[model samples]
Target chain A: MDIIAQLFAGLSLGSVLLLAALGLSLTFGQMGVINMAHGEFMMAGAYTAFVVQGVVGDAGVSLLLALPLGFVVGGLLGLLLEATLIHRMYRRPLDTLLVTWGVALVLQQVARDVFGAPNVDVRAPAWLSGAVEIGGLALPRTRLFILALAAVCVVALALALRATPLGRRIRAVVQNRDLAEASGISSRATDRVTFFIGSGLAGIAGVALTLLGSIGPTLGTNYIVDAFLVVVAGGIGQIKGTVIAATALGLMQAFLEYSTTASVAKVLVFVAIVAFLQLRPQGLVSVRTRSLA
Target chain B: MRPRSTSRHGVTRLATASLAALGVVALSACGARVDSGSAAPTTAESCVDTSGDTVKIGFLNSLSGTMAISEQTVHDSLQLAAEEINADGGVLGKQLDVVSEDGQSEPTVFAEKAGKLITSDCVAAVFGGWTSASRKAMLPVFESQDSLLFYPVQYEGLESSPNIFYTGATTNQQIVPALDYLAEQGVTSLFLVGSDYVFPRTANKIINAYAQAHGIEIVGEEYAPLGHTDFSTIVNKVRSADADAVFNTLNGDSNVAFFKEYNNAGLSADEMPVVSVSIAEEEVGGIGVKNIEGQLTAWNYYQTVDSPENDAFVEAFKAAYGQDRPTSDPMEAAYTSLHLWAAMVEKAGSFAVDDVVAAADGVTYDAPEGHVVVNGENHHIAKTSLVGEIGADGLIHTVWSSEQPIEPDPYLEGYDWAEGLS
Candidate 1:
């Protein structure tokens, strides 16, 4: 029962990672742009939820409203970033990296100025406050809700990326941008939509994140490195690879942390990842094309 | 994708190399200065300026980073104290001039700033250190410079420095009294949860000794990195252990996550209560009152303490800051520290370090926490220990308190079991 509970805890954390990594994977897979400001976008979403919650005194209803509100806010901001900054730095990945880091720092300062340095409590609704005890296992309602939310998001993203015409356009652009443009797919529109969706997903992840911990200006910073690790370790763009990698890493961290200290667990996780990378330099999954050979 | 990453990796390597080179250069520059500076003779006469009508004191705290949230409050209270002193009559009939510096929540930064405060700023004394790590970092600087530091935060015992005055409660005053409270409540088994740091580790050591002597079983002990948010696994361990209570030494944002997870695990203060040493009235609101409404905390003072001194202090604080801002233990301690310094300086009739240290003995103040007397031997002030229960209004109310101000025992010489634990 204890093992089961620990596993559940791991999975619940994994679900949040997966939610965060999905957006990162999509953007990096398609645009090849390292959005270092991804976590700030998540912070934006969390703050949006905070603002919404404040405006509407009811916690449950406010969270429901904050989801879509966060998406719009995060998505619009991403669109603005793609147009004003990321678009010009497409050919220079290294430059984009530096610029986005600057952007993240600026956004963090802006958050600190607006919300103050202290962590703010975003209360889970009364209905989601307690655990559901099943025999010897106690499953927390908040974790269950986040798990369900992540599952829905993954399914929706997978289906949309695989089945829809928009997905086809995004996939075509990823394969060959000029060719897709020649075929009247308009790679620019695809890039805009993809960036928007990716950032919006990060925002939604932020909303779920508030249920797990206190919200602060650096809230996104805490998870940004781990999210990047998930994306990088999962073969950059593969959804299936990201899911497996996140769950495995999360469970390993949870178990290691239980046995030892948090810092030791983190160090071990990084060492394991490095070792795993040595074995599989191309990550767990990668797309192969004739040009690569 | 493979070709792109190889080039990107090369760029990253180049950037990292240059950054490392810059860091090495900067480090050597500081090292060279330190070597020359330490070789010189040091004296308090050349350190501070006393000819002027204004006496300067430094206030060093982390104004940014993870510790900013808590340290900022301490900084504000220190400023308030300085302002109050200046308004009436400053220390030694000189206007209080505060030289503030940000510690940046790093031990190295604390040490560096402390040195700068004593040598460059030439302040008579420095106040404000929230964490044990920062206090430890500043210890050597203060000692070597023949300067004084008034640290206002509860810390692990087994430490005493002639250069530093601890206005906050030590382990024997706060942690041991907390254990006594739990024992009196008939708690036979306890779990330990804390942030992975010096204070928590040391406090737990003292707790282990106390438990062994008092016939209480320590079922489990766990530690998370500072600023760690995940508490699911630890919470699971707490539930499975079925201890009568949990002694939480977790600090900062970790408490928010821990309490949230504790509540979500269907645990409450009524069953398996968590008596925390870190969480105070300021943190209760941040962690959410609903999440930790009935939780217990061990401290030397609370905003809701019903004393005329406390009432006046709280009112003055709210009037200065705002009505909603809560006065906490550290803030109260910081306020007391300023007055304590003033009283000592007046008694000594000088701002010299030796004079101040000499007159520190028996210097008492009617502080917000009640009367606190300076222990000349250890340089810690005697404070009344209070065990508070967090109420729904996001405030902590005293459920129990020490009959009198607990004497300062920084080395824990009073307890036989704590002899080697330090």
Candidate 2:
């Protein structure tokens, strides 16, 4: 019974990791832009939910509205960043990293100034506050909701990237920018759209995150490194690889934590990732391309 | 080209030789220190200027970073205390000149700022430090400079420094009373959950010793890293262990996550209550009342404590800040610390460190928490311990009390079970 409960816990935790890392996978993995301010975008979404709840005074209704609103808020911010800063430093990954790090600090201070440094409470909807007790296992509705939300997002994103015309353009630009431009795809426009979608996904993840953790300016920093780890360890630009890696890491964390301790479990997971990277630096799934840069 | 290269090598060698000579001289100069039998080195003479109409005191706190949210409250309370003192005819007939510096939520920064506050700012004393790590980092600096610091936060015991005054409750005044309350409530089995830090680790050690002596079975023990939000697996362990109650020592934002997860796991205050040491009135709102309405918290004071002094303090605090702001245990302790310091300076009729120390023993103050006395030997104050239940209105109301103020026992010297533990 304990083992079964542990498995569900792992799956739910993996869903959280997958949700947080999905946007990073698109921006850092597919776009090849190191966005250190990606976490701040998540903070923005959480704050949006807070503000929505304040104005609406209804948890369920505000949550429903915050999703789309969070997407727009995060998308606009990403579009602004890419146009003003990231566009000029496309070829300088190192410079982009530093510049975005500075942007992250600035955004955190802005959040502190606006909302204060303290963590704000976002009350959960009454319907989602209870747990489903099946015999000996107690599954929280909040965790279950997060799991379902992650699944829906993954399916929607997968379908959108495979079946849509915008997806095709994004793929073309990602594959060969010069050829895509020659073919009249307008790579710059595609890049902006792609960044918009990626960061918007992050915003949705942030809105979902308010159900589980404290919402504050520094909330993003706690999960940002884990998100990057999932993206990097899964193989850049591979959604399927990301899914598998997040689940695997989540299960490993659960079992290790049960056997040892949380701090020890974290150390072991990082050590394992380092060892895995040393063996396969190309990650779990490598892109098979013939073009030489 | 060969002659130029040779000249460059000779210049480099000469510079290296001079640098090595300077390093030797510096090391020798440092080696002339006297052993004072304490961690502090040979002290510098006091540079505090008290001849003027104003006496400076420093307020060191993390105004930014992860700790900013909590430390900012301490800073605000300190400011309020200073203002109140100045209004009531300043300490020892001179107005207080305050110097504020940000600790940046880092221990090394705390140490560095402490040194600057003593050596450069030349403040007679310093106030504010929330975390044990910050206090530990600043301890040696205070001792070396022979300055005073009044730290206002409940912490693990087994520590005492002459140069620092602990206004907050130590183990006997807070944690032991909490355990006694649980034991009296017929909780025979327990689970321990805490943030992985010095305070929790030491507090848990003390709990283990107490439980062993009292025949309470500890079913499980788990620690999450500080700031770690996820608590699913740990909560699962708590559920399966079927402990009668849980002893939670989690600090900061982790409490919000822990209680949320605990509630989601179908745990309740009625069946298996979690008695937390860190959650105060201010934190109750942040965790959301719905998630932790009936939860238990152990502290020296709560905003809901009914007393004329407390009423006045709360009113003044709300007037100074906003009506929405809540006065907590640490904030009250900080306010009391300044008053206590003023009393000591008045009793001694001087601002010198030695005079203040000589007059500190048995000095009492009518603080919001109650009438507290300073134990000058250990440099901690006697405080009453109250166990509070979080109410629906987002405040903590006292459900249990120690009945009278308990003396500070930082080293647990009175307990036979705590022998050789420190």
Top of the candidates by lDDT: 2
Q: A36-98 in candidate 1: lDDT tens per residue?
A: 888889999999999999999899998999998888888887888999999887777778777
What shift in Å separates residue B335 of candidate 2 from its native position after superposition?
0.5
Question: What is residue A17's positional error in candidate 1, in angstroms?
Answer: 1.2
In model 2, the runs with Cα more than 4 Å from the true position are: B1-41
- Superposed on all Cα atoms, model 1 deviates from the true structure by an RMSD in Å of 3.3
lDDT of 1 at B330: 93
Per-prediction share of native contacts kept: 0.46, 0.49
**Clashes in each model (backbone N, CA, C under 3 Å)?**
0, 1
Candidate 1 error regions (>4 Å): B1-44
Candidate 1, residue B97: Cα displacement in angstroms equals: 1.7
Docking class of 1: acceptable
**lDDT per residue, candidate 1, B191-245, as tens digits?**
9999887788888888898999999999999988777878898899899999999
Model 1 DockQ (Cα-based): 0.48
Provide DockQ values for all models, in the order shown. Answer: 0.48, 0.26
**Alpha-carbon interface RMSD for all candidates, in angstroms:** 4.3, 13.4
Tens digits of per-residue lDDT for model 2 on B344-408?
99999999999999999999999999999999899999999999999999999999999799999
Cα miss at B117, model 1 (Å)?
2.4
